[model samples]
Target chain A: MNAVLHLAAASRVHGEGATEVHALRGVTFRAHPGELVAVMGPSGSGKSTLLTLAGGLDAPTAGSVWIEGTDLATLDHAGRARMRRTSVGYVFQDFNLIPALTAAENVALPRELDGEKGKVARRLALTALEEVGIPDLADRFPDEMSGGQQQRVAIARAIVGERRLILADEPTGALDTDTGEEILRLLRARCDAGAAGVMVTHEARHAAWADRVVFLRDGVVVDETGADEPEALLVEESGR
Target chain B: MSIRQAMLAILEQGPMYGYQLRAEFEQRTGETWPLNIGQVYTTLTRLERDGMVEVVESAAEDGSDRTHVSYRATESGRSEVSEWFATPVPRTQPPRDELAIKLAIAVTLPGVDVATIIQRQRSATMTSLQDYTRLKRTGRAANPEAPEDLAWSLVLDSLVFDAEAEVRWLDHCEARLRRAAADRPAASAHATPTATPETSDGVAR
Candidate 1:
């Protein structure tokens, strides 16, 4: 199957010889349609770096990133930006919604910037808002809603216009327990609807919603668990 | 800890023979703790001796020349079930969890790659977590209001929570081990593995 997001042996380095920092090294990853992959790692484990590279926000110093069979390295800056707008969606920890815009407007902003007409963009935004289960809040501004509702608006923005790849960095970091879980449920539902998703999270409970988990350590892929591996008992039952 | 009490608890609501009792118990726990009919009968025999349950035999009502036997909780058994529910499960003594013990000893052994052990275990646990989550995804999404479905889901949720906690603890252990190594990369190399590694909470780095 073609991957919606793929990073092949991608590596990123910063600074000179004396103080070089390898944010990621030889990390290969993929997320196919109908799958959500969670990246789990401690601080400075290159999780955010991986997300940036996959989103084409940062270019890898080595290897390549492919989004929906298109090698990002082959695309120029304008091309990459267009790809980000058309195919990729990013949700950040802080629920990055423009304060001045209403919920529908915030969601419509991306599609509008992508050259979509106002009527088409607003319709798409309303559909996305409905998909995230908050259509009634479309007219409410970011400040008019709670954190969870604001995050829902942010997600509606990311998922508007049939975006194929969703990349979320700590998508639930700012919400409370129940609200965070509700957000994860929305992500899981999106993936189930055939959009590939890659989420970077420190919380294992949030990662449990993913179809697979990739664990990073020291800028390297230390371990990965495919959702299909079916032989082992839950660890608590291992001794029994 | 006795299957007898669980059987009694179920029987408290209605009567069941040995196999029926086993099935009922399995249904409630999603078969997480399966019991053989023999074990069920053994526990039943003991419960009968203690006067906690009484068996009723009915003559062949269908004229098939077969007798049916079922046990119902006695008054004493009802009291016992109530007491069991009233009391909290004890946690003074932790269960013998092999993974925790393995890490405990692995960290002490000289020349042992504790990080590898932790990493492998984490991977395995995550796989199990995935399996459980998949089961949850498929098994849910329909008939959620059914009692049996709710029972199964609750059991799966427990396993998911346990596995996630284990992963977090593994991450925490890795962090501790890294700090320990960085603190004494030189001295710890030649020192005896049995030597106690200082774990100061005050160490900032």
Candidate 2:
């Protein structure tokens, strides 16, 4: 399927015995190259759990999560960390910018951590910053930039090294409406440029920008609707 | 938006014919609410009848083979424009809320699920809210400093805020409904559990 991300029978169970909580259960999902999928569900429905698992930040209890045909479960700690640093990009609702670093340095940190030369990392960071339409702010620190600009810098960091998969969790929650849309447009543009994206958003309008939507309910995938058939998921979501 | 007040405000700028008024209004509002020339003419006629405006020069008097007639705002028209600017938009009775109406009807109608209606509308409203945000961004990018862009951005903000409020209201409704069902277990028991299988269990999650 040319899938960039594949989760088969994935489950996440926290604690054990009396304190056991199943965050996800048997949720099989896939996102192909060039596709942006939106994962939507109410709180505690396992949306974040699924995203964390897919990004290899958390391992599933029984199933497997694969990125570009490599199973995350099979990777050792260092291997998983290396894969995460090289292959996956994560964005959060809060801008999550490093406070002490300049925007360029913040974007460059990931590459530098991966053993790239300082000069090469900075150059790549500048390129990514420019791609996000904010190269002018490359030298500005996180505190010097507005919420939107900080987010752009964060995004620049995420896609700095041509990461194939991007995972965002309510990335626009901190911005105003217009600024939020601008961020979404940038994300959409990134996905259009051929990176597989899975954004967890409660807003359907943001979901509209996605190529498809996977709806979760109580740790299970209740419904999935294609871009051409958004209304289908709407109807199903409303319990019709 | 009150087209009448907007037309009056435009006339306050200078004397303009129907076509000119339409063009000016569209220019300021970025064609968000396109003005119909026929509507403009009709509004001008009413303004003149109400002594809010006067014909500056009728097309018949010009003898220039131009069918354009210009009108200027009278003292009363200028006052109306001033008042419109001074007064805050009235929201005592909000414009007809279709979602509210649907939920109201659903709650009373047998076999109708109010929660479903609210959720469906919340989803729709969220979609529109996002679309408005996108449009606002596009407008800003096209001309950030232009008056039309600012006006349209403000309009988009209004929609976004209202949609956000509607979603909150739907959530409130859902919570209230769940609470009510929890409080009156027997009352809800008699009501046919048709649409919501999860809720039918009477163990409110």
Candidate 3:
């Protein structure tokens, strides 16, 4: 399988001297097309740092990040930004929806930003919402929706652009287990549909949806055990 | 074999009690499938409860004057065993254990000392590897030509594989730990407040 996203010897540091904190240290991994790779790590293990760098949301202090053969570090700021806006989707833990926009409108924003007409954006957004099983709630604002519904909307917005890469950080953290599983099923379906994805999650149950699970510690890829049976990954984690 | 088939296979040769069946099974299989005595009795009792087996009156051949209750497969048990033999056993995927999960979670929690955890795991894994190596050596010396020698060798191979993999994993673990320790502040000296964003409910990716 060809890797759609690749990180090689990536490192990210915050501050300097006595206050220096290495968020990522020589981390490396690859996420392939039609695969959902779950990044598992404790709080400061640099899993998020890896994701942000992979998504082009944050630049690595050292090493290279490649998405679809384009090295993020080599691209200009505007080039990277455009790539993220058009080819990548992000699902933040907080949902990050515009407060004033309705669920459909929030999902439509990406398409609209890409120059689609308002009507066309709305139509595409509704289709995206339906994909997440939230078409009926399209007009509802973020505040009016439940946490799970909001996350569904977030997912809708993420895939609305038909981005090849989707980066999610604790995508189901706010929802209960059943709803989380539902969200995971949706993510799995996305992979089945040929979209490459990387999800950072603490919950093993949530990560079980992925084709592979990679363990990170202090910003480096420590272990990877999956790409086959997710249940084995769960058992390995539990045995630890 | 399915549990039913295993039970019937044990009884088909002769009527033996639960403990005897278990001992025979271990002996036959070369102890590859270890079953607790309690589990053996529990399965036997269940088989009896389900009418797949029936108790038979018996006495020890040695005439110890002790009553030994035996069980034989019933007609239904024979059918079940036959069906079991016809059916293919489903292959189970290897276990993805929780150790990786815990290690992943441990690295992300605030105030967690990743280096310390890796060091501790390294030492523990090394100790286990040494113990398994010693056990394998002892087994080889004690039963070089025993009938169960092949089985002992298989067990030794598995242990060696586990230990070798663990040692390699420890090397990776320690390298990452050293990098983390060298890069981060000492846990005790830096009292950074835990980043408890009300919205940050889980470990970030």
Candidate 4:
């Protein structure tokens, strides 16, 4: 099977010499198109670092990162940025929206920054907002919207460019249970729309929404289980 | 500790209200452990039902007032705790966390879009890290001199450790994605090696 994204012997470190901390220790994984994979780990397990490196947001100290048949490390900074803008969509836990901008404007920013025509970007942005079930809220500013609404807008922005890869880091962290679930449903909807999504979350319930869950510990993939497991592992642990 | 053992341990210390039980458990364990109030009460009620513990006295029954119910461990409860203490801890099987499996399958699944997912996860993780850091800072600032400060510090350490680890993992995932993308054509070619059909006429299938 063709991997849409692949990591080979990837490692990331901070600082140098004795002060250096190896956040990712020769870690490797892959994700294909149309897959919704959840990365689960306790604090300091390097899950987010893997996501960012996969998304071309950062460079690895060793090994390579591939997205859509291209080595991101081989790309020039501008080239990497272009690929990310055109192919990758990101949804953050706190819904990283410009509070001053209307939802439509926020969704359009990526395309607009990529130098698309204003009208074309806005039209696509509106379509993306509709995809996330928040078309009516397009005119509302981030501050005016609820947490779920803001997240929907974030999702809208993420999919507006028709990016094939969508990464969400704890997309529901700030929301209440119901609201978080709603955000997760939106992410699922995005996958249904043919965009593969990856989410990093501590909440097992949130991870349960994904088609698969990857467990990490101390910067390594420790275990994995299908989403169809009879009960969430965390719940089972609590039960024990 | 098992739920029954935990209840017995709490009662052995002295009578405690439901909320008090929850707080004390969390405090004693440095909040590395989590117990919902419902879980505590449910366990306590179960102990009472099993005759392992009994309510010595009920302070009040009014709905609006704080009702304090004091419970003491029975002889059986004491025996249970003793057995619990004497028993060696059971080694649990390693968790088969669903997320890791999903990620592994996602990486190899035909036509799956792995990079986008990582990007989305990176954003979400960063946001969570920020929130956790803020909460940790606020907690430390609010209780600089509290006796439970050490416990709070431990929680903060855990939060920081998780957030930092997640961020690092996301980076590693991205790098591997880039490499896989670069190697796709060659890998795919290697995966589809030609094979001869073993029929009457050995023709390539």
Candidate 5:
């Protein structure tokens, strides 16, 4: 499969001089089409930094990030914003849906903002909601729905249209066990359906849903292994 | 499950020979715990001796049928099975967890990187948790409503929950260590400046 998201030696540093903190350091990562790559690390380990950079929400201090063969560094601010809207879908730990909007409306907002007609965007939103197994919930507001339902809506919003790259950060943080499993199943299904996905999660069980796992520590890629070889991760970590 | 009870329980349904009992037990429990035929027969012999089960027949004189012996649960065995079902599994005496013991020792031992041990164990547990979830998914997909399938799924969920709890406990341990370390300097300043004897009451990080 072609690489849908790529970060070549990407680095992100916050502040300058004595206050400077390196969030990511020369981390080269990639998520290919139909693959879900999970990033696992402790707090301050730059898992979120890598996700934000991959989603084009943050720029790398050095190196480059490419989505679908297009380097993010090459895009202007307006172009990058358009790219985020049209190609990259992001799911935060919080649902991040506007309370005033119903599930369908929240999902449709992105497409509508991308200049798609309201009717077309709504139709696409309903389809995406159906894809996430909650078409009936499209009319429910965020407060009216359960956390799991809201997250399904969040996923619906992320996956609406032809957005081929989905980035999720602790998407199951607030969910119960069964609900979390359901969310992982949805994300896994999306990847199986051909969207490249990168998720930042502190829990290893959450990372297990990915096809592969990337371990980050102290702002660098510490280890990378297939999901089946998780024990190998510890072996590799011991070497470090 | 105890082998003696399992045998008696299978016989509770009806009279079954040793091999038949073994097959039925394996079938009902989804074969997650394989019981050897020899163990089944041995348990049955003990059950019969204990009056929990009685052998109905050894064999007929006919040359064609001489190898099989049937057994049925006696009143005592029926009561035993019922009691087993009534009582919950004991939790007062918890099973020893190797990871827990290892962590306990690692925390007290000097020069051991307890953090690394916890992290490694967390990774291993997470792998097991993932394997359980995947098994559950595949098992359900193959046999959605089978009682056997549900039993195995419940078993897998138990493993997942246990592993998750271990990871959480490991994180808690690390956090507690950090907090204790952070409080040490403040704690030292409050101690008497003179050559006071060390107190065993001082909290160990």
Candidate 6:
């Protein structure tokens, strides 16, 4: 079981001297292929910092982040950018779809930016859109679609190339409960099909969708759970 | 939680023997709440005493004294069933939640580390929550179109929602405790007797 995303004692500190802030401290985390891991914490607990470090959007002040066997710190700016486009996909709370682009074009932008042919990128985007259950909405612009639809487009973009790692930060924050569950279902299905996913969420109900949960607090890893088989409910009724 | 009301509700459809009523109950509740034969019979007797059901007794086999019996809901019982459905279950008397009580007690005790209590419970509840979700995923894919799926899933949904709420509450409790610890001045250390009331005021967070 190779981990698609791995952080070894990762620490992220902002500034120094009297005004320093430690967003994360000595936190080792991993998300393996075919698994979805949820990161949960309070507002200042570094959940977002951990996600950015794992996705290579930010560097750790100490330790290292490895995505699909490549160390993020070892890669230069161009190298990290290339890694992000090729292997890592990010889903934000706001959906992050470009209003100017249609759903297909939005999904295809990632593939096109990575230097694939326009026709080929669009084809790939169409396939990803189909996987997210919105193939018919490929031509719909962000404003023309509902929040859930836009999120589907965002997820299609994330998984466009069968990207090996998916990073979602509060991915369902903008949607209603049923729609959020639908998005979670899509994320779960993608992970089940073999991508590693790390999602940062404050809602425990949303975290319930993940295969495992990592709890952070005060810039450190506080606890971890959900890897083992789920135990029986307390006071389950006996005898029928 | 009321076997008596549940049995009456099932009997409203038609007359049913004790075992049959139990089967119907288990089938509808996704087999989560199992009832022993004795419980069914006991509840049936109570329902009969309350004028909610009527018993039809017959001699068993070869002229034996012991009898076989079936139960049918009386008109009153049918009305009760409808009333139960139409009215919301009252929350005035919630079952004792031992975890909540334990944490509440632990927070007030001297030398108690409330954060550890919350963390351990949160971990356990999250695992349970995950299990419920796994059950839901497998259950959904296994029988997506079955009519029984809704009943089963609704049961699982209750469990998932409860566990999630517990975890969130635990998180809330920890945050409140942390805020209390931060707000109390070092001077409060010397005035430990008066600090309890002030700490209780930290409940807002």
TM-score of 2: 0.76
**Which digits, one per residue and each the tens of the lDDT, describe model 1 over residues B21-97?**
88777655655676878889999999999999999986655989798888889999999999988988899999899
Error of 4 at A89 (Å): 0.6
Best by TM-score: 1
lDDT for each candidate structure: 0.84, 0.79, 0.73, 0.74, 0.79, 0.83
Give the total clashing residue pairs for model 1: 0
List DockQ, one per candidate, in order: 0.32, 0.10, 0.04, 0.02, 0.13, 0.41
Tens-place lDDT digits, model 4, residues B1-205: 3766976877788877788777766554434457778888888898899989888755675755655787788899899999999988866864575556776887777656565465456555544544443333344422457655665556655655675676577667756665565566556522221111211221221
DockQ of 3: 0.04
Query: TM-score of every model?
Result: 0.91, 0.76, 0.57, 0.53, 0.82, 0.89
Q: Could you give candidate 3's per-residue lDDT for residues B1-205 as a string of tens digits?
A: 2555786877887789878888666544434456778887778888999998998978887989888888989989888888787987766854675556776786667666555555456444444443443333344422457544555556545655675576466556656655565466565432222222221222222
A1-240 per-residue lDDT for model 3 (tens digits): 768899987889898977788888777788888998888777888988888898898898889999988898789988997888788899988889999999999999988888899999999999999999989998899999998899999989988868889999999898887688678778878877989999998665455456676766656565565443222211211232
Please, what are the lDDT tens digits per residue for candidate 6 over residues A1-240? 789989998989999977788888788898999999999999998999998898888999999999888888889999999999989988999999999999999999989998999999999999999999999999999999999999999999999998999999999999999999999999999999999999999999999899889888767777788577644442232221
Task: Give DockQ: model 4.
Answer: 0.02
lDDT of 4: 0.74
Positional deviation of residue B150's Cα in model 6 after best superposition, in angstroms: 2.3
Model 1, A154-240: lDDT tens digits are 889999999999999999999998799789889999999999999999988788788888888767787787777445333322232
Best-fitting candidate, scored by DockQ: 6
Off by over 4 Å in 4: A227-240, B1-205
CA RMSD of each candidate after superposition: 5.2, 6.3, 15.2, 16.4, 8.0, 5.2
Give stretches of model 3 more than 4 Å off: A229-240, B1-205
Model 3 - which docking category? incorrect
lDDT of 5 by residue, A1-240 (tens): 669998998989899987788888788888999998888877987998998899898999999999999998899999999999999999888999999999999999999999999999999999999999999998999999999999999999999997999999999999997799799999999999999999999876777777787767668674565556333311211232
Candidate 1 true-interface contact recovery:
0.44
